[model samples]
Structures are given as C-alpha cells and as structure tokens.
Target: MKKIRWLPSQQDSHNRWVVFFSLLMGVLLDSISWSGDWGVAIPDVTPLILLYWVMAIATNNFLVTAFFFGLLHDVLYHTGMGTYALIYCFLLYPMLHLRLQIRNKTLVQMSLFIGVWMLAHQVLVWLITPANHLAMENIAFWFAIPISILLWSFIFLSLRVLRRNMNVR
Candidate 1:
C-alpha cells in the first residue's frame, strides 16, 4: 500500500497564485473603459467582484478577502477608499456564512450573484458619490451584469475542472 501526505506549504503556495490571478483580473476588468455617450466612457462590468466572490467560495474567510479586494478596487477606481471596502464587507460576509445553503449552485447562481452584486455596488457608489449625479443616470449600465456573470462562470468552472484534472498522486 502507498500513502501520500498533503503539505500545508504547498496549499499556501497555491493560494498565493490564486490571489495574484484574482488581483490581475480585477485590474484588467477595471481598465476596460468604453465610450457610452458624448465621449463619456462608462465604467461597468466589474470582473473583480466576480472573481472575488468566486475566490471567497473556493477558499475560506470570504469577508477578509473581499475587504482586501474592495480596498484594491477603491484604489484602482479612485473612489472613496472605504466605499467598496464596506460594501464587500457587508455583502460577502453573510454570503460566506450562508454558502452551505446554496445547493447545486451553477452558472445561474453566478448570473444572479453578478446582478445582485452590481446593483448593490451601484447603490453604494450612489450613496458615497452624491456629487456624481450622473451615476444614477447610468444605472442601466448594470445591464452588463449578465455578461460578466457568464464570463465569470466560464472562468471559474474552467479553472475548477482544470485543477481537478491536474490533481496528481
């Protein structure tokens, strides 16, 4: 008989890669600014949040991770430093606690989470940036939510399948 022992260090190294990829994805998502009207580029479709949520589900401690990513988002988007920080803390914490209740979560779940998450993010932005009245005018920009959800679902599931296939003895 043969036995194999798992190493905590190996898992930690893997987690480091995951964090790096998540951060990169967040930055990439934030960088995509397309013109909407009057040369005003609408900044929507936050893949960072999608990746953050997926990472939270895959790993433990969703709140802490979400908070950190939220801070990163604030820095990148040049919004109030704690706007997304607080939102991520509020939305993802309960999600972590109640994750077990989400049975058979599929792409549909990803789509739904994206829609809800975008709506909540927009609301928080509105609350924090009252001077930016245009924010509300463009709330329909949230229609991008479903596309982000689908993209995230593909990325998340593909990565999961790849990892499972690569598991070595």
Candidate 2:
C-alpha cells in the first residue's frame, strides 16, 4: 500500500486548485441563488443555503477572490458585467481591514461574519438593482442570514481544521 501524505505536504498545491475551482463553483451557485419566481410570501432560501466559504483562510485575498468570483457571477447571470466585481471589492475591504479582530474569536465570530456578509451582499444588490424592480417584502429574507452563517461556520471550521493539520499558517 502507498503511504498517505500529511496535509501540510499537499495543502499549498491543493489550495491553488481549490481556489480555481471555487471561483467557477461560486458563480454557478450564485446564479442558482437568483433563479426562480417568488410566489405570494415564502422567502427564497438559496443564497442562505449556498454560502461560498473559501476552503482555506490563508488564501483570503478578499479583493482578488471577490473580483474573480464577481466577474464570474456577472458573466453567468448576464448582469452589469462589472457591477458585482465592484461591489465585492467594496464589501471585502472592510472585512479585510477588520481581519485581526475576527481572527481568533470562535464560532461567534464566524456567525457575525456571515451576518455582515449577507447584509453587505443585500445592500449592494439593492443599491445596484433598479429602484423600479424593488420587491418590498424581500426584507423578510433577511431572516435567512442566520442560516447562511450557520452554513459558513461549517466550511470555515473545516478549513481551519485542515490548515491546522497541515501546519499551515
């Protein structure tokens, strides 16, 4: 039997490929997040259900990641091509700046990040979408924020565990 390599030995190289695939996956998932008609009252849960937590925290260059994924989102959804890119850069700026405050905080920190990320995404979408198309009751969807956060926690924790096992800093 071949010996299995430790996570540290393979993480860096594997991380690069994971980032590439994630960009594609992020766009595809976000498109699904936007599809389908809203019926009388129930809130759409896709965005909350499809949170795209990066697999490794160390790969967190929010601007670069955001720009790439946003571009993919725009291309796939056929929206203002660069709009999401700009919004993502703007949204990620604050997150990156506050990185230290969030670093070691525990699951609560991840939960807070999810709420903030969802809020940032919602605000940007609202700001960019034409006022004529606004849906008044879309506000009910904010309740989905917690769900997205819970989803994010799982991904974030998995990445953390993988990184720790690999001795990646």
Candidate 3:
C-alpha cells in the first residue's frame, strides 16, 4: 500500500469560536429552511457544514458536536426525537474515516464528498423517517442533492475563509 501524505493544515487550525459558530450557523440554516415557507430547494446545511469541519479541521471533535447538533435538530425541527441526532451521529463514522481522504481544497472533490454523503443521508432519511412524516411525501426533497452539490463550493470556500479568519485547526 502507498503511504499517503496527510496535509498538516489541521495543525494550523484551532479557532474554537469559529467551529462553534459555523456549526451553529449550519443548524440554524437547516431550521430556517425546515420551518420557513420557501418554495424552492434548500440545501441540507448541517451535513455540508459538518463535512467541511470534519475534513478541514478536527475530525474527532466533530463527532460529539454532531450528536448534539443532531439532537438539537431533532427537537427544533420536530422530526421525531433522536432522528436527526442518530443520523448526524451515524454520519460521523464515515466522516472520521474519510477525513484526510477528502481534500476540500478542490471543488470537484468537495462536490463528490458532499454528493455522496447527502445521497446516503437522504436515502437513509427516507427509509428511517417515522411513518407520520411520510405523509408529506414530496418536499422538493429530490432537489436536495443537486442543490447541495451546487452549494458545496460556496460553502467550502466560505468556511475556508472562516477557518483562515479564525485560525482553526
């Protein structure tokens, strides 16, 4: 097996407030889209932000934050208790392993990671969502993937800037 070089960018990043605010922004955005009466596609903000943080900063720390955000998302969105928490927490395993592998410095790579994760997350959401929520069948939910893919670059770049500003590792 080839020994891959993991970049030392994490060593340069260490802004706790940025991490907190970025994750917080993600959850807030998700909630706004969930509760708002918007008629268009809204990207799944949580995972996208989570992916960036996991890839760009401290991957291990995010698992705990993911669980909390998941619970917060569950309660705020009313998608049923533990649903969002479980999904967010469940996603961390992949994120942890994929951390160094996914270099978000490039748009294509970021798109690939975002697309795959969103697809998996949505598919799982479809399967695991409680029966009661099944009633709202078409949520323009299908647009989630493409929208998220398109937004990944913007979010990635924005977070890159945020990371730079905060100096988070």
Best by lDDT: 3
Q: Which stretches of candidate 1 lie over 4 Å from their true place?
A: 1-8, 38-59, 161-169
Give candidate 3's error at residue 57 in angstroms: 1.5
Which pairs clash (backbone N, Cα, C closer than 3 Å) in model 2? none
The global Cα lDDT (0 to 1) of model 3 is 0.74
Better by TM-score, candidate 3 or 2: 3
Residue-level lDDT of model 1, residues 1-169, one tens digit each, is 6866576467656665665565566567667665654222233434334344444445555555666777877887687887777876766655565555542466677557655665565566667755445855764545445555566566556556644554411
Computed on alpha carbons, the lDDT of every model, listed in order, comes to 0.57, 0.56, 0.74
User: Lowest-lDDT window of 10 residues in candidate 1?
Assistant: 38-47
lDDT of 3 by residue, 75-167 (tens): 876778888878887777787887777773468876977788887877767777774254246676657778889999899889989887766
Off by over 4 Å in 2: 1-14, 33-60, 131-133, 161-169
Error of 1 at 159 (Å): 3.7
